[model samples]
Target chain A: MFSLLLQSFVCCRFLSSLWLSQHSVVCLLLQVLLTHITISNSQHNTPNPTMMKSIVARAYSPFCSVFATEDCDKLANDLGYEDLITLLAPHGDSVGRATVRDSQGMTNTYDDFAIRLGAKRPTERDSGGMLFNPDAMEALLREYIGHYNSDDSAFARFFAKLVAAPPDTAFETFSQPAAHLFCVSSRNAHPLDTLQALAQGQKRDKDCLNFYVLVHDARVEDAENSTQRTIALLERAKKRFGLAGMIKLGQEGVPETIPTPQFLTVGDELVNLKTGVGFGSRTLSQPDKESIRSLLREFTVQHLIPHMERCIMTWDTVAAGKRGLTGRMFSAGKKWLKFGGSEKQEAGSSIQASGIYPQGSPEQTIRRLADYAFMLRDYRYAYATYELVKRDFLSDKAWKYLAACQEQAAVALLMYTTRLTEKQRVEVLNPLLDSACYTYISRLQLPQYALRMLVVTSDLQCLLGPDAASQGATQWFQKLLDERLVGRLGYALIMLRVSYAFSQSPKGRKAALWQLLSAREWADANQKGEMAKCLDMTAPVYDELNWPNNEGTLLTRLKGELANEAKPTSVAS
Target chain B: MSYYLAIVGTEDNPIYTQEFGTYRQGGDGNSRFSPEMKELAPFILHAAIDMVEQTASRTNQLYLRTVDNFYSHLVSAFVTAGDIKIMLLHETRNEESIRQFFQEVHDLYVKTLLSPFYFVNQPITSPVFDQRIKSLAKKYL
Candidate 1:
C-alpha cells in the first residue's frame, strides 16, 4: 500500500509540474496577444474628431496623419496608400519623406503598447484624454485634413495651432509617417515638448521644429547648439519650414533669458516683412501678412483688452484721480491708435492732439471714436470695430497693435455681455479668453495685464461655478497662480470681487469666505494704500457675517471698527 | 441760394455762425433770405436743434429732415453722434437740388468737424471753417 501511494504521489507531482508549465505558456501567449490587440486597436482607432476639429479650426486646414506600417497598410487598402502619399507628399518633400520613412522604421514597434500597459494612464490632459489614441487620431486626421484644400487660411490656422504647440500624441499615434515628417520639419519635437518650449519662450511659433530650436537656444545657454548653429538652424527653418516673423539668433547667453526691449523693436522688421511697406497702407494681401495680422488681432482682442480693462479697473481703485471719461478715452484711444487708420477725425485727431504720440508718431492722432464706441454702453459698434480691427491687424501681422486689439476686444466682450448670443458668446468669448490666457501665461511684456487677465479668468471661473468643464479652467488659473505669474494679492482681490458678484443666494457667504480670506491677506501686506482702502471697504461685509475669530475675523473686525468710527449718520430731524 | 449755418454748444449756446451763397455757375455769391426770414434766422436755427435732438434720440443717428421752411427756404440738419448739428437752410429749385446742396454741405460739415478749433456741439466760429464752407458751396453747388 505504501509503494502504491508513493507511485501515485510521484505521478501527481509530475502532472502538477506539467500543468504549471502549460499555465505559464498560456499566460505568456495571453500577454503577447493583449499587446498585439492593443497595437492593432490603436492602429485602427483614430483621433477624436472634436480635438481634430479644434486643431483644424485653429490651424485652418486639413492635416494628414503619418500611419504606422500596419495602420498604413489598412488605410492604404481602404483609402489607397499611393493617393494618401500623393496627398501628403508635397508637404513632406522627397527628403522629408525619406527621412520620415527612415525614422518610422527605426521607431516602429509594439513596445509602446506594452509600455502603455505597464504605466497608469492619465485620465485626461488639458481638455481631452489619452494624448495618443490611434483610432481617434486617425479619425481626427481625416476630418481635419480631409475636405479642406491645403492653401485655405483655415488650414494654415490649423497648422499654425498644431505647430504652435508640440505635435500631439494623437498626432503620434495616428500617423507615424506624418509624425516623423512633422518632427523633422517643425521645431517642436513633440506636443508636450512644444508646450514646454512655448511655456519657456512665452510665445507660440507656427514653425514647430524651428521654434523649438530657437526657443531652446533662447532659454538655455548651455544647450548643445552654439549661437551660430542656432542661427543656422533658424535660417534653415526659415527657408525649409517657411517660418515667418522675427527670430532671435544671437545670444545674450543666458538660460531663461528675459526678452529684451529689442524683441519688441523687432516688430518693425516683422511688420515690413508682412506689409511689404513700412506702415504705409493699412491692408496687406500676403498670406504671411494676413496670418500675422490675424494672430496679432486674436492676441490683442483676446489678451490685451482684458489686461487694459483690469488696469483701468485697478487704476479706478488705486488711481481714482484718473477715472474720468477723458482718461478712459485716452487709454482706449491708445489701443486704437496702435492699429493705424482713422474713424471720425476727432476720435483720431483728439488722440493725436493730446500730445500723446500715436503708434507711429508723437504727433499722430489717436482716435476717440473707438473709445466712444467701446464705451457707448451699446457694444454693437464696439464689437464690429473690434472685429474689423482684429481682421485687419491679423492680416497685417502688426504684432503690437494686434496684441492691443485682442486685449480690447476681450474687455468689450466682457463688458457688453448682453449683446452676445449664446453661440456668439462661446465662439467669441472662448477664443478671446484662450488668447488672453495664452498671452498672459506666455509672459509677453504685459505683466500687469497678465496679472489682470488672471483675475478675469479667475472671475470667469467663479462665475461659471464648479462644473467639470470649469474645473479645467480652475486648474488652469491655479496653475497660473502657482507659477507666481500673478501675485497672491492681485489674485485675491480679483477673486474677492468675482466671488462677490457671483454669490447670489445664502451660499454666497460661504463662497465668499475664501475670497475674504485672500483679501485679508492682501490687506495685511498693505504696500499699496489704495488697495488697502478697497480692502477696508469690503471688510464690513465679512464683519457682519461674524464667523469664527481666525485671522480673517480679526482683520475684518479691525477694518469694520475703523470704518464705523469714520462715518457718522446724518438725521433729517 | 443763400445759406445760414449755426453751430450750437453743449449748453445750446451759439458757438459760430456763417452766411454765404452758391459761388457756382451763373449764381451770385450773396445771401438771398427774405428780410423776415433773416430776422427769424436764429429762431429757425434754434428750432432745428430740437428736431436734431428728436431725430438723433429715435435713430441713434443725427440726420434730421428739412426742419423749417420760410418762403421757399429749406433748412436741413445733419447732427453727429456727439450732438453737433450742421444746419443748412438754402433757397434752391426743388428737393433734388436741395439734396445735392445739402450733400455738399455735409462734406463741409465733416471737414469742419475735423478741425481742432471746433468742439462737438460747440459753436464753430472759426474763420477757416467759414472760408472752407464758402469754398465747398462754390465748388459743389
Candidate 2:
C-alpha cells in the first residue's frame, strides 16, 4: 500500500503541476482582457470626450474598430447625452459619426446652425454653461448704445439698436429710458435724401431705424414761400410721426443790423417759439433801434400781448401838468378804448376782443402801459401814467416807475426854474423835491436808479446851502449816504456835496474843511486805478495852489489814503 | 375743392394761386368756384403760411382746419414746415368725400413736382401739371 501510495503521489504531483500551469495561463489571459476593457473605458471617460473623439477620429481611418467598439452608453453618460444631442441637432452633419451616433440622431432646432455649433451647454464636464451671463449682456448692450454721440446717423443707429433690442435690455442699458432715435443734422445735405435713406432702411428691416431729418440753414426760395414750406414740412412730420419726430429747417446766422421792421417781423415769426432775443451785456451797451425793436417786439408779441392787451396805456402826468384834464384823460383813457369803438362809446364794452387780444383785462393793460411809459424819455407823461397805475399796483413795477418819474420830473422842474416865481417855487419845487427825495431814499427799487437819484439830490442840497429851506434835503442826503443804498461812489459824492454846502455857509469854514477832508478820503479809497493815476497827475497842481492853508498836506494825506485802499479781493455776494 | 396755393418768401411776401373743383365718385370735375375764394386767395395763402410757420416750431403738428372763412369759403393748410403746401377751401357738395379728393390732389402734386425743374413754392402754371391735375380730377371725381 506504501509503494502504491508513493506511485500515486508521484502521479498526483505531475497532475497538480499541470493544473497549476493551465490555471496561471487562463488567469493571465483574463487579466489582459480586463485591462483592455478598463483602458478603453478610461480613454472614453476622459474630460472633453468630444475633443478626444475628434482627435481620435482625425488620426484613425473610418473603419477604426477602436472607435466602433466605444461604449457609447458610458460615453454619453460622461459627456451629457442631452447636451450632445442639443449641440449636434443644428450641425449633425458637421459632427463626427461617432458623436452623431452618441447623440442618438438628435438635430439642432435653432435656425442658425453655425450659431448652435458655436454655442456651449453646461455639462458635468464643463465648469460653466454657454448661456449668456446677465452681466455680460449688460456690458455688451452698454458698449453698443454708449456709442451714441448725437450725430444724426449715430443717433439713428443708437435708436435702431435700442428698439431692436429686447425692452428689458434697453431699459437696463440706457440712463435716459425714453430717448428716441430722432436726430437733427446741421450739415448741408438735402433733407429729402436723408429722409428717403432712413425710410428705405427702416422699411427693409421692420425694426431697423426710426429717423427724423433736420435741414440746418435750409434756404427757402423766398420768405413767404419758405414759411409756407416750413409749415407744410411740420404738418407732414406731425401727421407721419406725431410729435415724436420733427425736422427743423434752421436759418443760419442772420445779420445783426437788420432794419427795425424786418427785425420786428422776424421776431414776430419766432414769437411762436417764445425764444427771447439773446442780447449779451455788450449788445445792451450800444443797443440800436433794431435791437431795441427786436427786444420790444419779442417782449410784446411773446410775453406782453399774449398775457396783456394789444394796446399799452400810460397816463402822462407831466403832460397832465401842462394840459390838465385832456392829458390825463388821453393818457389813461386810450388804454380802455376798444379796438373798433370810440372811447366814450366803448367805456363799458367788453375788454375781450375776440381775435385782437386774449388777456386784455384792465389790470394787464394798465401794467403793460405803465411799463411802456417808464421806458419813455418824457418823465412828465411817465409820472402821470405811473401815478394813474400806482393805486392799483402798489409797491411793484408800477409803483417803482411812478417814483422814478416823480424824481425825474422834480429834477427837470428844478433845472428850468426861470419861469417860476418864489411862491410857485416854494409851492411846486419844495414839495416836488421832498417827494423826489422820499422816493429816492425810501422806495428806490433799482440800484443804478437809486445811485443816480442820490447824486442829483446831494447836488441840489449843496446848491441850496445850509439855510432852513435846504435843511430837509440836507438831512435826507446824509441819511441816504449812511444807509449805503448807494455804493462807495455815491457816498463820496454825498460827502463832497455836504462839504461844499458847509463851505458856502456863513461861519461854517471849519465844518466845511472837516467835511471836505472826509470826502477826499472816501473819494481816494474808492478811486479806480485809472482815476487814481489821473488824480496823481493833477495832485501837484492842487498842492501848489494851496487855496486852503496846509492844503498840500491834506492832499498828500488823500494820496496816502488812496494807497491804503485795498484792491477788492471778493465780489459782492 | 377750391385750392389756394401760396409761396411765402423768407421776407413774408406772399405769391398766391388758386383752383376750384370737387373731384369725387361719378361727379363732374368742374365745380362753380366761389368769388369769395378767388378774392381772398392771397390772404388765405398768406395766413396759411403764417400759421404753418407758427405751428412748425411747436412740438405738435395738426392741420389747422378752416382758420379763416370769407362767406362760404374756408381756408385749410397741410403744412410740411419746410416746403410749400397747397391750401384748399370750398363749399363742398359732400364734406365727407372731400378728404379723398384732397388726398388725390396731394398725391398728384407730389408726383408732378418729382421732376427737378419743378422747385418748391413755384407757381404750378405748367400745361403738363394742368393736364395731370385734370386727369386726377377725372379719375377721382
Candidate 3:
C-alpha cells in the first residue's frame, strides 16, 4: 500500500512535469486524484490492483472500444477515448490483453474486452472556424468533470474503473472448436455502437467457426431490458433458420468444460423419430452446407459428445443409487426419429420437433449419427450404430444408401477396430463386404461403382488384411457376366480389369484378345451387340500417344467394329 | 556411420532433431542404432553442453571440433552469435563435412526465424526443415 502511494507520487510528478496540459486543469485533476486516493484507501482493502503504472499505453483488439458516439458524447461530452488511445496504442499485430485476477489468482482474461474510454473536443471551432486554444479545452474538461462528479455517480464509477484498469495482458486462451462462441466488436465506436456493430458486422463475415454471438455493450441502466432485446433478436434468427438454442439450465446443469451449443441453426431438414414431425424452415446453400458439415464435425467432437458422456455418467450414477434420476432424461432415451408413426402430434415432445437432429427416418438418423461418429473417429460407436441400422435396411429397395452405409462402416472398422480378427473375416467382414458388392450390382444397378469399391478398398490391402475380401470379392465382378446381368458398361469394366491385370506379363497379348472373345461368348447370341459396346467404350477414350502399343492395336480393331456398326445405325435412325 | 543431429536453443530446449545412417556404402539411409545407443543419443548430446559453454566463453570461434565423447559416441558443437547451439553426435568423425552441414542448417534456421508465425525459443514444427535436416544428415553425416 505504501509502495503504491510512492509510485502514484512519482506519476503525479511526471503528470505535471511531462504532460502538455494547461496549468489550472492539472491543479484541479491533482485535487480530484488526491480525493480518489483517499476514497480508495478508506472504501476497500485489496492488494492486487492491476492499476496503471507511469507508462500510459493501450492495446488494440478486434473488440477494442474508443467510446466515441452521440450517446458517449452525452456521457463525457468529447471525442471519447482519443487521448488514451493516442497515449497507449502498443506496437505489434499481437496486442496486449487484460487478465481478470480474482482472489484465486488468475481466473480469467478479457483479451477482447479491454475497452479504453476517452473524450476530446472537436478540432474545428464554431466561432468563425478559428483554431481552438488548450486553455479553453481545459476549462471545458473541468466543468465536465464537475458535472460528472455531482449528478451521474454511475458514469464517475465507470470512469474510475477505466482509469484503474491495466492496459494489455498476455494472450492465453482455450483452443475450442471454430463454432463455439463468436466475439464481435466495432472498429471505432463507443461501447453502445460497438455492441450493435459487432452483431451487425458478424452477420457479414460468414465464418462457420462459432454459433453464439456475445456482444459487450455499454449498459449503465436498464440492463435487463438490453439483454432481453439481444436474446429476442437471436431467437428470431433461430426461428428463421430452424436454429435451436439448447435449453439453458442453472449453474448445476451446465458443465464448465463443454461449451453450450448456443444459437445453432439446423442447416439441413431434420425429422423426429418419436414425434414423427419434419422440422426445417430453410435450406442452407451448398458452400454453407460444406461449412456447416465441418462445424458439425468439430462441435460433435468438441462439445456434444462430451456433454453426452457427462449425461451418461449421471445415468450410471442414478443406476448405482449414488444419485437420484434427474427429471429431464435428455435425448438419449428419446427415439430421435419415427419411421412409420403418424399418430403423434408435433406439440407432443418439445425436443422431437426442434430440428436439432438431422432430418430423416430412424434409420437415416442412425446413419447420420453413425457418420458423425465416424468423422469424430469413434469407430466403435459408428460400427455399433451401423450394425443396428443395417439390419433394418436389408431390403432391396434401400440398396443404394444402405450399401453406402455398409461400405462406410467397413472402412470405419478397418481404421480403428481391434475387434476384427482373422477368424472374424470369414464369419463377419466377408459377408458384409460381399453384400456391399452384390447389392450395388444386382439391386442398385451401379456395377462400376460397386466393382471400384471392391478393387480399391479390399484387394490393395491384401498383405495386411484377410484374404477373404481379396480372393472372394473378385467373384462378384465375374458373376455379373456369368449371370448375364451385365450391360455394355459392365462388360467393358471386366475386360478393362483383365487387361490391366495382365499388362506386364509375357502372355498379356493373348490374355487381352482371349478376354475379348470371352466377353463375346458371355453375350451369348448377342455377341454383335456386346462387340458394339466394347467399340463405343474405347472410341471415346482412344488417344494415340497416351495408349500403350498392345492396347492401341486392340483399340484399333474396336474402332473398325464401331465404324461397321455405325453404318447400320445411321440407316436405322 | 550413424549420426544423431539436434538443434538446441539458447535455453537448452530442442528445436529440431534427426537421425540417419551412412549412404556411402550399399546401406539404406536408416539409422542402424542399437537400442541402448538410440536411447543414450540425446543424453550424450545434452552432457556435452558444459563443454560447449566452457568452450563458447573462452573462444569466439563458433565451431568447437570434437568437444566431448562418451565411449564410441563423438559429439561436435557449433554455436551461433545469437547463442543457438547446434550439436551432432556421430560414431565416426569428419570435421570439414560437419562444418558444411552446420552452415547449411544455419542458413535454413535464419530463414525459419524470418517466418512471422514463429515465436521465440519454441520447438520447431516445420516439416520442410525436418526434411532438409534429414537430407543433410544423409548427405554429410
CAPRI-wise, candidate 1 is incorrect
| Tens-place lDDT digits, model 2, residues A52-77 | 22221121111000010112222222
- How many residue pairs of model 3 clash at the backbone? 16
lDDT of 1 by residue, A140-244 (tens): 333333333323322222222222212222101111111111212123344334323333443232211221213221334554564455456556555644432
lDDT, candidate 3, residue B103? Answer: 88
True contacts kept of each: 0.00, 0.00, 0.00
Q: Model 3, A207-231: lDDT tens per residue?
A: 1222332231332355566556556
Model 1 Cα lDDT, one tens digit per residue, B1-141: 678776555545655667776666566877876664554565456544544665566775455667654335676776655555667777664455545555665666677778887656555566776787677667655
Candidate with better DockQ, 1 vs 3? 3
Candidate 3 segments whose C-alpha is farther than 4 A from its true place: A1-365, A392-405, A416-426, A434-456, A459-470, A476-573, B1-141
TM-score of chain A of 1: 0.27
Candidate 2 global TM-score: 0.27
For every model in order, what is the iRMS? 29.3, 36.9, 28.5
